[model samples]
Target: MPGLYHICYLSVAKLSALQPTPELGFEAIKEKTRKANSAAGLTGCIIFTGQHFLQVIEGIQEDVEDTFGRISRDTRHTDVRVLSEGPIEVRDFPEMAVNCGGDETLTAEALAEISAVLDYPQHQLHIREIRTLLSVLTQPSRKQDALLAG
Candidate 1:
């Protein structure tokens, strides 16, 4: 019933601020993403910023990681950067979705702390964006909560 998942943010190349392409725009592929993931039984979130794509895939660890590997080789995009990848004791996300405005800043220290927060329950945590989610968990203020969130 529970398994690991992979969370990564792919920073795509630059695009027009005034007029961006649908492939890179966060608002352009909502329905398509949801339908595709739903059909494939793959749950994840895709954050598009008209430049980069932050996708979090949650499923059986093997399936999710394999999918990430597949995406890395996909010829549809140019740049593919891996933000995070590992086996979570629990599912950080149990479904596929996407959102915009994930502009929170983070540090290497915070990223390390976040590594412990991924095993949290959906409602016990207040994090929505991937960056902030990792930052908050890594914070000392959140260290204690990580156990509770888990």
Candidate 2:
């Protein structure tokens, strides 16, 4: 009951909120989440790609569950689906309360493929894949930087 637990989920962003710039309203949300999560002793990361959000939250069982519940009710997200959740021996992100990543966006089709993989009966085996994908996607891309600078 009282142990370190983690939950990962994927959700579509409310199109309207994305607005003129997806970061405009979402930056505030991210800051609020970071502060609240820090206060609750939680650590995790959120990856947003203009359309979808993939997040991993880890902490005390109750705290992680409560945060997920609150996020499910948040108006900014839609089609919320838990990708994976269970007790973890250690945290993947121990230092950051919340890390937001969107350097490389995932296509809708790719997201669907990932969701399918994690939804299968042998989903556990693929857990690390998703985490690794998140880690790679989170990294800032020099190619993107160059394009932006050009």
Candidate 3:
């Protein structure tokens, strides 16, 4: 049962100015990430706060690790620090290979929630808490279902 579950990780990185505009660069990055993640059977959400990127990825152990490996090497990400990683019984993001686009309010809420979870020392985090945090951050509201709950 444990092996059948998905591996999830939270990471934060500085955004790089690789395109003419941050929005343009983010779109390109997200497009590439979505396609690659779908091919790898991965699922997750990424929240960009203009200055930084916070993301969570979930998939089979090897697939998740491999995806992270590629992401870590990408020039667009810097100071990538994984906040937490482990196996989970359920996927926090079951529908999307990658979820990135949203208004600034959504981004702010997600970042604040993530910050609250990370406020605990890494070693102090429990698997259940991690799962809960991911669920809370990634779950789309009823109104957003039409747009993000694919």
Best by TM-score, which number? Answer: 2
- The local distance difference test score of model 1 is 0.51
Error of 2 at 22 (Å): 2.1
**lDDT per residue (tens digit) for residues 80-142 in model 2:** 989899999988888788877643354455445545544454654355766766655444564
Instruction: Give the Å error, residue 62, model 3.
Output: 0.8
**Structural similarity to truth (TM-score) of each candidate:** 0.51, 0.74, 0.68
Position 72, candidate 1: lDDT: 72
lDDT of 3 at 56: 80
| Model 1 lDDT per residue over 1-150, tens place | 645566565545345531265443434445665665566566665544434455677667766667777767655445676667776665444533433223232333433344334323352333345645533433446644653564
Q: Model 3: residues >4 Å from true position, as ranges?
A: 1-16, 104-134, 142-150
1 or 2: which has the higher TM-score? 2
Ranking by TM-score: 2, 3, 1
Instruction: List pairs with backbone clashes in candidate 3.
Output: none
Considering summed lDDT, which 10 consecutive residues are worst modelled in model 1? 98-107
Top-down lDDT ranking: 2, 3, 1
